[model samples]
Target: MEHLAYFDCPTGVAGDMCLGALVDAGLPVDVLHQQLSGLPSEVRFTLAVQPVQRQGQRATQVLVHPQGEQPHHRHWAEIRTWLAEAHLPPAVQNWSQGIFQRLAQTEGRVHGMPPEQVGFHEVGAVDAIVDIVGTCIGLHYFNITKIYCSPLPLGSGTVKTAHGIMAVPTPAVLQLCQQRQVPIYDNGIDRELVTPTGAAIVTTLAQGFGRPPALKLERVGWGAGGRELPLANILRLWLGSPPASALTEPVVLLETQVDDMSPQGLAYACERLREGGALDVWIQAITMKKGRQGVLLQVLCHPELVAPCEELLLQETTTLGVRRQWQERRLLPRRLVTVMTDWGEVAVKVAEYTGRRVNVQPEYEDCARIARTHGLPWKQVHQQVLHRFWQDMGQES
Candidate 1:
């Protein structure tokens, strides 16, 4: 079973709040401390977790207290090196570094400097580092396979930072949101709810931002913030297992009909679309209005690529407009396995449904390459690859 986590951020999200939620969801504090102890000697901090009430809602509050004097400002290169030298798990190290990298890039853009040269002020503190790294450690400990989050709530008014009083949602926070195209709304709260650390953490780690997906309801963890507000100042984390049927994901289908473009142009357009990240691109002959012979072009891609794909079609083809629709496609879990054949090694695609192997086929590209190299018939090479795969698996073809 795959474990999934959903961040329902009605108030907002921060690195520390994420850690607290993970802890409240049953992640052991001792485990977090033990793993965090692997950081460099210069990094010194301790976690403090306690039950807290936010606007009458019970939640866990996690605080990262600096243990000793630490640098008030650190460059991105310095933090990157420290994380690389840490003795943490590979996944933890990668994720922690990725979060900080996003922060550095966003700050660099705001301050007109390179990412490596950007100096982190408030986020460079030992406490923020613990919040970022500890959050990764918690997620790794829970074995979370997928993450979903709600649209972030943006607060109003200004906030005090190491750089002095800055506008609410700050420059770095707004830049991060814009980069990820994260959905945000003003909640009429005159405070800085979503900090730069919070924005960087969620925007970097979350796979999608919207309503939670269909899941078997499990435990909910509430991470409380540091202030009281009209609403509960808490970040809610929903953890559960999604059904096998949830394997289906939403995709965008872009379609256009063209009769003026030459066949070569249409083919070129299709290739460009494929190179631009379209999952599939194809064309079919069709009769348009007035009995005109035309071709219907279709492109399948993730929602994020819809704009670029459409732009490519418009620029590369004679189509005046592209029709788009969202679709949910159920997909079989598949993997590639290499098999040794007489000519060379060929890859075979294995597809599974409901945990049972449903189909197996040799990759045509791999088979064709080997066939050309060995001066053998393509069909014969394909058969040999399949035969070798079945033979190695000890199964009858």
Candidate 2:
């Protein structure tokens, strides 16, 4: 059972809002306090969550109150070191570091400085650190396997920062959105909606954007923002598991046509795509404009791999743009079993439907390896493995 969290950011998201939503969804606030206490930071703070109302909607507001003088600024190097030295769980540490790293890189790009040389202003504050780390801890606590988010609503007007007043969807937020090609829209609110911390957290962690995926929703949590707007100023989080009986899962299909690249280059691109997590890669000969012969390269991959797969096509092939679309694919339940043959052990793949075996075949690569070592025909080895698997199954039954 794969558990997922969908961030329905109709208004927007912030680090504190995310923490609030996670806690509202049943993550104990004490868990965050216990885990985040492991961070090696001098600035002491405590997390507090209270039931709040955002434009008449009930939600949770998580606050990080610093207990003492906090650092005015923190450089990327300092934050990285703290995360590395922390005694927190590896997942939490890694996730928190990743979010902060994205923030640093975006700020660096906006300020025309190298990422290592970039120093965080508002994001480097003790509260932001706790917000980021606490969010990761909450996700880890719930065992969230994947994260999906909606198109972020970019607010209007301006916002104040340690760098002084900046435009809404501030420079760091805009840079982060552009990096991932994240979808955004103007929400027509005369204030800052998406904060830099919020943009960094979601852009770094979310696997896909748009509508939520198919899930058997178990719980809903609303995290309220500070300001009250015409609508609910909350980040709604949906927690659930993928349906057990559903055989179809979502995928992305990437297609591009390249007439100039060599056949060898095309083959290499396909190899790279497969290595990069493409479920399937194939090419079809086609005639393009000007009667030039071309091959349409197509890649089927999980939605999360869309960015990398599209990148591979553009970099590895002679194509200007790649087309992508969401798709559903039906899959059969399958398992692997090893069978002992005369030469060695070979793996067989068995596919089942409705509790009955519908298809069974020897793993081609394994059979081929055994055949090469034994100096036997590959076909003979394959047959022997299949025979041995059924024989073993009969004995077991």
Candidate 3:
């Protein structure tokens, strides 16, 4: 299975902190420097590799320094123009612009101005810019096609910044985080932990947030924050093959025989079971103890939700008792990938086995759309999509 890059943010991540960690993870700092070589005199930086601890674990953190005078606030248009024309790689520039765009929107709301009308306050500073741009370049070097982040720990309380002591989680940070499912916690570190720029970069670049998946472990890197604390100054990185696509888990299958239940009655029971969290519930035809035909009610669900759903089975089905037990099954990791179809953009589900692409099928929504537009049978559209995908892959090969 192909691997993925996972960021473990025990301590909150900052733009500089993330960039520093990527550097520690072996990004080409010298190559990154060469691209930013001739920037205006307002920006200067120092990069160093050092060891730090997080909780009780020791890891390396990259420290960045933007000494001397900082730059003045500029409008989004001006900043974006320079970024667009910069000599940086396309991926780096794209990532940086995305982060900045997120911050600009947040600032716009805080200051009661349009995003373009908002000025870059502390974030516009030369050092912050360098930190973000450097991080973008570093990620490009890794050729990270996809990234997933752990839930962010947005610190609590207010901290002093160029914009005054507004709040611990600044307006910009709060605004950016509100739209995402990233988790926030307050551990009494009443300081500014999740910066707006950092939030932008991490969330924009990462596809989703969750714990590490099944993967073959490879190289791991830790980026450290330059702060000296009782705890460690480190950000952990895990580079490995994603966990096995099919995970082995125990599931309970419930069965009950019904000889006198109406189809509607059976449906009601199944619906209730589903509401109670049965994985699947349906009827199967079978011969009963009296040699009479009957419908077999079956439910497959997690062991935990089985009891609650079982009550529904007893109440709705004609059967006096239900048989239940456990079964082992392998579940695949599933995600929907959007493909550009001749009709338009259609969603297709990609199923993987140990990180290898094993199946790709068009989504019902897409199949229906194609059916309506071309006035063809829905099944035909679906079949065509499935057929075309493999053909396209063959052409690519």
Q: Estimate each model's TM-score.
A: 0.77, 0.88, 0.62
**Candidate 1 lDDT score relative to the true structure:** 0.85
Model 2, 176-271: lDDT tens digits are 887776768877777788899999999999886777877889999889898899878999999998765444566778999889999999989999
Question: How many residue pairs of model 1 clash at the backbone?
Answer: 0
TM-score winner, 1 or 2: 2
Single out the weakest 10-residue window by summed lDDT for candidate 2: 242-251
Each candidate's lDDT (Cα)? 0.85, 0.86, 0.72
Return the top candidate by lDDT: 2
lDDT of 3: 0.72
Give candidate 3's root-mean-square deviation (CA, Å): 11.5
Q: Whose lDDT is higher: candidate 2's or candidate 3's? A: 2
Runs off by more than 4 Å, candidate 3:
1-3, 38-44, 52-58, 67-69, 243-397
The runs of at least 3 residues in candidate 2 whose Cα sits more than 4 Å from the true structure, single-residue gaps closed, are 187-190, 246-250, 290-292, 302-308, 328-333, 352-359, 375-377, 394-397
Q: How many backbone clashes does candidate 2 have?
A: 0
Per-residue accuracy of model 3 over 1-397 as CA lDDT, tens digit each: 3446777877677777777677777776678678766344446777666666666676666555667765557678777887877777787788888888877887888889899898886778776788788877776676666576776778777677777777768777777666554556665565566777778877677755556544566667777766654446556776665446564444668998888878888888888888888888878799988698889889997644555767788887778898877565566878776666667777888787866787777899778978998899998878777777777653431
lDDT of 1 by residue, 126-219 (tens): 8889889998998898888877778888898888888898888899989988876577898878888888888888888886666676777688
